[model samples]
Target chain A: MGHGGGGALSGELTRHLFTPAYGNETLGGLGDSAVLPLPGARLAFSTDSFVVRPLFFPGGSIGDLAVNGTVNDLAMSGARAAYLSCAFILEEGVGLPVVGRIADAIGAAAAAAGVVIATGDTKVVEAGHGDGVYVNTSGIGLVPDGVDIRPQRAVPGDVVIVSGPIGLHGIAIMSVREGLEFGVEVESDTAPLGSLVEAMLAVTRDVHVLRDPTRGGLGTALNEIAAASGTGVALVERHVPVPEAVAGACGFLGLDPLYVANEGRLVAFVPRTEADAVLAAMRAHPLGTGAAVIGECVAEHPGMVVSRTGLGGTRVIDLPLGEQLPRIC
Target chain B: MGHGGGGALSGELTRHLFTPAYGNETLGGLGDSAVLPLPGARLAFSTDSFVVRPLFFPGGSIGDLAVNGTVNDLAMSGARAAYLSCAFILEEGVGLPVVGRIADAIGAAAAAAGVVIATGDTKVVEAGHGDGVYVNTSGIGLVPDGVDIRPQRAVPGDVVIVSGPIGLHGIAIMSVREGLEFGVEVESDTAPLGSLVEAMLAVTRDVHVLRDPTRGGLGTALNEIAAASGTGVALVERHVPVPEAVAGACGFLGLDPLYVANEGRLVAFVPRTEADAVLAAMRAHPLGTGAAVIGECVAEHPGMVVSRTGLGGTRVIDLPLGEQLPRIC
Candidate 1:
């Protein structure tokens, strides 16, 4: 039977997978929409779709990843996240228990982030018609006054900062999908960055650009900011943080850590004078304990991102023209 | 290649299947989101997903079907729709041209409704992984002040009115899927209802409940309204408009038109004293030219819906407990 059928199969998916992962006070009631109290501030809205393969990977499952991913995107926009709308596409034959765990994780993630799930939708596809599950979430948050940040706002001479380490999410997913094992566990860097973002925003309003190094990783994000702002970026290899396990995994797989994905970390571009204050604020947050100034914007080579290598060579970091790891979210 | 790749395969589907059926200005560009001007009112928002099978059917294609379906949902909320976001899931090996026509139809329908397509997403699945295409659309509309209406607001003595005939969309899809078309064409009555809704809101602010008879048809919508408002509904079969072709098809297929679906029609609940005025206003609109008084609310049988047949027999109309036609949106 198709997963969309309103029968035992569909019930299992909803009960086990969706409900547990995304369960919240409003979601527990299972109404058409989640009613939320409006807070005082301008709202910031964003939506993203996740199709990461190997539903359950080291350090996290798709359910938690979905929640954290959307939360982080909103955080980058300097918004205090409020509510989320979840829509799911499930394939027939997906075990109900797995779905339940995913739903549970989603619920846990939302709870940790202090946000509510307000509205949701579910659809089932034929077994062969879809991947195991695809989750699309749309979230809205309140953007406090005087916090204006956008990718295009990165300016020449601004200091670039990254919160904590990168590449754990990409490598963690790859390890599971490829059935490889490392002596030390490498979990996904999946966690809500709302608190850290809030801390940073509270410390300074001069944050010009904020982005999570997802799909294309730190390199791609830098390239995008540079292109969008019509400026160049220069990164110091030593300053950028990379967990040892993630770096080892990348090296073994012939992957560049710079091109890998990270869910919990974010890059911020701030005026040179405010960089230290922003870094200090980030370091105070548990998720951003390793925060450091990793790069600086440059007027030369507009729309380019160049990294100073550890061995004294400079390499231009460009966007991947095609999909690197399909279904890596 | 997932359908949401925003790449070649996705472009092909948009050109073939979506274009001819629902083409419109904002949809034509196929951008990230649709952008529309606020039409002098606060916004009303609604979203729906269509998983109807046999994507192409008599009278309409899923392309136009998806556009009008969502547009009508927004209209039912008494909003002057301004924008729509379309998301697609394509089964690999589905012909590209078919998808393109669907995209075109979406664009056309938005143009006809004076709405814009501000954002879109596409994902592709392996062959047999999906039924041909599933479209999810979210729409936003501007609602004028003093036009508060909801299903829970219906009261006893309120008159029930329907904009035009019922069951066209259901029969249209059924005829195609079952290959049992009637001699006369039974076209899916799929169309945008923003103009009709605007016309009604222009006449009176006393309208109480507005709903579209889509998936479970007129009976299901009425039952929902009755239950939501804690009131009973008495619908007269003779007063309900069912096109001859649709009626004949339903009889032949042993299907109840009351449980079928409609695309372009709506059911409005208004004060009995002002029923005539609301019907007159609805009739003035092009989409509601065939509008008629269908029934009235009653204090008896709270939360129940009963239909008085032409022969004087009455039967309870309730929500379908299970899928009548899988993937019928």
Candidate 2:
């Protein structure tokens, strides 16, 4: 009954979760590893693991979530993700139907992002020895010439941008985890951002930093960038976009939306001169329709991040010393 | 308290299970990952995960087992391994010292193999959601040119050689898991084979199939080669040199050593004309001091593996239908 058996359980999980999120023509039906064609461009590779609980939640399941998560990570690096490797850890007694649903979602997500799932592995654990399922994905992409973006490249006065509203994914998962159902549905913000990043990159290659607000969310992500780049970041609370439903959910849970995760959104810092052009391009993309300029890099208070409150007060945002929601992707 | 926390518990496990069996300078320090210099050859990369339970047993602990396991996998390609990436999945509340011992053992194995640990990741899981710990290691090695060793290269009449004994790892894990300890020490044959592989490659570029029999044992590995190369394999069981302790352990457990796991050994298929030279080179290496010729490839019975038993009877060794011993690294 273990996930690694290659029997009914394993087949069901793959058929539902993996195939749906990552299916592609050339993936050779998902073997040990995807044999990929190396393009001429320089390669950028990244891997991530998702251990989110409540496999099925508002707006998404772990299947689509895993695919979009890796795709976006590749996008943040301004790379065209070409292939992916998926490894699954499944717990005994997980329903076959649920696994199939997840795989279908993976296939759909991969098709939507124009990426392929080339290689994969499946391992199953006894009921008490594993969570429902944990997914790890490693992706390889092509970074085009004339494009150079890194956190260290951020400079003073550079504008910071958020691709869309934050905290939706985290709040959505929390609601499901706590069995809190709202009258109005609060969906997760889980979607691939490759096109949005492509559009932004097309406008200007001056984008210095691109990060998804996952785990510790926007607050922690910006703080990391500040620390890594040895620069300070200042943000206007009023300028940061948060969906009303997400705000209400966070308020009820006594959680800071800024500390909540977002799967479909990205935070980008671009040169001051090209900020407007990049914002315009971001706005044109479907995934970045609500994109906005949130803040600017500052020379003062190096390695610090501060935000101006609506009532004229400012507060320092620090990196989280611990996980806010463990296993929430 | 997850096994991968990089905290006290993880540290303890590394020290106990890993350091004693495979201690060395480069691995003794136990960093995030191993760092080894490439020294001017194209790197061959591979990775594997160990989820074996009953942490310590006759053959080895998961710590030293995983370290040498990945090193041998890379060595199978005739590459000089340089670095390793160790990632852990620790269950909550696992003892700190247990984790440390595992880390220490990893360090020792890396040192003995002359590799370095350059990077690592640790994650903790809630109790009852995971086993003790699962270790995944990725290794990079430098492969010189004109060394095109692959399973597909096994030709008709190529001699199959096994460097040292086999199945010690699998039987050791099984014995501990079942609480059937042998009277005598039945250690897992866990050690890095990089030097032995280097010696064989030094003698000839005609080495075709290089494999380490880990999961599903020697039978499965050879079957994989047969299928990949569209050939057949014939094994002389009388000629295979399994230790008395291993044979006794397998007999008591009603298990076949040929189907048991081995962490520190390898099987090489080479041209008959060059077999002696390769064997001599293997014998000179400390790890392969017990090297022996156990099998050969043939054109007939394509994609099959047959063994000549001690009674001189021929028997087909089919690929294992299901896992004989789950979590045997």
Candidate 3:
């Protein structure tokens, strides 16, 4: 189970298992998406499978996540998603209406994202051999010329900015799973971030690195960037955004807001000179209204992420060994 | 389970469930793979998920099926596969070595097919929630400029030819699954068909249709083409190739060889004038040595497939309502 947690175990599986087996340069880069140079265009490709426990969540369902997750992966590479291929693994006894609802949600999500479901496949497993349904979506996007974004491009003097509040999506799923709730309901912030990324790129194409803080949240995403680029990340803990409902829920649940998963948010590492312009452009978009600068890339303590606490002490934020919440996305 | 049977139930699901939900031109076409016109090239994209039981089979495993299935789909579009993205949904508690062997198979299969595994993803489901593993592969291929192959292009004057033997894959899996044995062990005819398709195209780009008779075998594939092209098919029952072991197994199992599944064979609809040349080209390829012309498209009885019996009688071959063997792919 830890191998799917998107943490240290997941990283090890890719390094020791997948990379050794695959032995390819494109996959060796370990980016959020693989960019292939075609005849006249460079295309970004990515894939993700959603096995969340509950079929439907507070603000979203697995259907929407299937679309947005891959779309966000392509956006991280500075690409506008153009087409998606969807495949479903359905349990035998599941009702047709349930499958219908999920398909409807997928249709709506693709429409909202301005992408087409170009191809699809479906398979059924005998009951008890599968959850109700599992959806896998793979996307292809066009990378505009002169725009380059990758984890390895992060360098010293880069400013780190997050699109919005964290921990809501993780806490939202947990609240329903465990039947616990704060005074205000926390909804999964699942939405397409392609336009938000395009807005930032419009300001400048010099964005060094862009990653969506998904399974292991903002803290783990920063750690990955630091390691991939061989630079250090210095964070101001107080500047990180956490909604009151999410914070209250995490407090009772004994969870850290920084390590919770988010579906709709992204962490961008831009050159210090372009940081202000990028932040302003992000704020101008509807999905990035809560955007804030939370950290900076530093030359000290390369490959590590250290945070300055509100209590005037510093602590290292390590990659999580396993998931605190499994199957949240 | 019948919904995944590649028969009548599967067609209804696609027509009433998927088509209404998706409501797009490319998806409505319902080709084995979708051909998208990009800036400088037309690309073919396809996706498939492998949930075959007993991960390891006689001649191939789910790993090779995951690669070859999607690759064959792209090949049916007259495109040589360029790249594939693989995703795995693993059940908790499966051994690492098992995953390693499967990954090695995928790597070797991709290398043999002349395609690259460009990107991948993995997710783990808790024990009892899934089978040992389910693999999903999505592929992208570049379509040649002057070659156009699709189901609806099968004209009445087209001649039908099959690449090789049928019923071997389905019977091989059944022999292992049910603990039944014939005098000689039957092996799955699982092999990549991209090179064979290219060879036939070299003979004639005027080939109208090409489909890998996978799940529902030759009987169902011809029905689909007949329905799609609004034509009738006349098959000579004696001319369709079936190996001795496969024929013996199907006879004892009370199954018709026409409806049994095949992995490596293809059914092509070529113009009557070019059929001889294409058949010659197919016979020259390693994978198509057993190729034979079995039938022809007809103007009588549109949208149906009728076969001439070995007894000199004629009968309609209906699309199967449900799977005779489940999860054979």
Candidate 4:
């Protein structure tokens, strides 16, 4: 189950099974999205499977996660999602009302994201053969002209900005999973980021790296970008936002907030000169209201991440072997 | 279970759950594939989930089935498959060897079909939360110019042709499911139809309907076409090809081969004038070596299917309420 951890195990599995088998140009990115140049348009294609244990969560349900997740994936590639394909695997005993609720969520999420569900498939397995419902959503988005965003584009002088607070999504799901509710609810920050990404692109086409810290949380996402770009990431730990309720819950569960998952947050790498404008643009969006510049790419210790501790000591932030939570996405 | 039957229950579920939720122009076709018109190309998009009980089957495994299944869906739209996105939901504890074998098969099948696995995602659920592995593949194919194929395009006087002998896939799976052996082993007929469809298109662009009889077999596929097109179908029962091995296995299990699944076979509806040329083209392909004309669209009893028995009697082959075998695909 840790394969969903989005950490070492997931990387190992992909490298072991998929990389060698389907080694080709478009699939070579191994990024959040695969960018392809179609005849008349450059498009981004990506797929995500939602197996979140709880059908419903504090802020949203799997429905919102499924749609927003894929849309955000395309957004990470600087694409505006236009069409999506939804595939559902439902268990036999799941009720019609539950299905209806999920459908409504998907429809609403797509509508909110300004994307259409162009195609879809539904398959029902015998009871016990599957969980209540598992959804696989694949999307195609149009990559705007002049915008080239990828982890490989990150460089030494790049500034890292997170769209908003992290660790909320994982804590939200964990709260429901463990049936423990904090006094102040920690809801999953599940929302579409097409507009947020568009806002950033409006400011500058020089955006280098864009990634949603999903299954493996912020730590794993940063580690991946660092490893992929062969650059070091130095973080001002205090600048990374964390809500009080989320922090309290993580501390209670003995979990690192950095390794906890998030659904709607994104980490962006941009040139230092343009980072201010991009940060302002991100901050203007509703989804990016808490946007903050938290780190910068460094020349030393390439492919590693170091964060300044409150006591002035540097701590190596390693990618967890596997996420503390599974199916958080 | 039966919801994936591709029969009455399947249609009912789609009508009740999926149809209303995803009622867009392209999705409403509810064809084997959704036909999409991109900026510079008309494309066919389709998705299928493979949850066959035993991952490894006799002639082929779920790997081959996943690739060929999506490719065939695109081919049904008279399209040349170009790219596919694969998403896997694996159960924890599945051996690496199994995953490796499946990936190898997927790569081989995609290479053989002349399509590329463009992008993919993998997620693992906890042990027992899933069967060994379930694959959901979504594909996009280019619909050639002057080609328009759909079930609703079928009309009276259209000729119906089967690409090859049917029921091989279903029986192959059943043989493994029951652990029963017939003197002769039945192999799965799973194969990509991209080149085969191209061959038919080369002959004429007037192919009205092209459908792969996977679940619920030929009877259900024709019944669906009849109901969708508001036309009656009359078949020559004796002309329907049934392999000796599959027929024997079905006989032993007291199953109707007409309702058995076939992964590689397709039934085409063509105009009477061009049927001979199209048939000749299909017969020239190795995958269509066993092609035969077994039926025709008719004027009587619209939205129904009637077959002529060897005794000069007519048999109404109603679509089965659901498939006899679950997860056969």
Top DockQ: which candidate number? 3
Error of 4 at B65 (Å): 0.4
Shift of residue B142 alpha carbon in model 2, Å:
6.0
Error of 4 at B81 (Å): 1.5
In candidate 4 the C-alpha lDDT for residue B94 amounts to 88
lDDT of 1 by residue, B148-231 (tens): 677878999999999999988888777777778599877788888878888887778878888887766887788778866899
Model 4 lDDT per residue over B1-329, tens place: 67767889878877777667655566778799888877887878888888887899889999999999999999999988888899999888988888889998999999999888888888888877788889988888778889999999999999999999999999999998899899887889989988998999999998999999998999999999999999999999999999999889989999998999999999999999999999999999999899999999999989999999999999899989977998887
TM-scores for chain B, listed for all candidates: 0.85, 0.85, 0.99, 0.99
Docking quality (DockQ) of candidate 4: 0.67
Model 2 interface RMSD, one decimal? 15.9
* Stretches > 4 Å off in candidate 2: A1-45, A95-101, A114-118, A142-148, B1-47, B56-60, B77-85, B95-97, B104-121, B139-148
Model 3 Cα shift for residue B38 (angstroms): 0.9
Ranking by TM-score: 3, 4, 1, 2
RMSD per prediction, one decimal? 11.2, 11.4, 0.8, 1.2
lDDT of 3 by residue, A1-329 (tens): 99999999999998899888877888987888999988998999999999997989899999999999999999999999999999999999999999999998999999999988999988989988899999999999999989889999999999999999999889989999999869888899999999999999999999999999999999889999999999999999999999999889989999999999999999999999999999999999999999999999999999999999999999999999989899988
Chain A TM-score relative to the true structure, per candidate: 0.86, 0.87, 0.99, 0.99
Which sections of candidate 1 miss by over 4 Å?
A1-43, A93-99, B1-43, B56-63, B90-101, B120-128
**Candidate 2 local lDDT, A62-116, one digit each (tens):** 8878788878877877887766555566676666566556766777788788876
- Top-scoring candidate (TM-score): 3
Ranking by DockQ: 3, 4, 1, 2
Q: What are the TM-scores, per candidate, against the unseen true structure?
A: 0.82, 0.81, 0.99, 0.98
Better by lDDT, candidate 4 or 3? 3
Model 3 RMSD vs true structure: 0.8
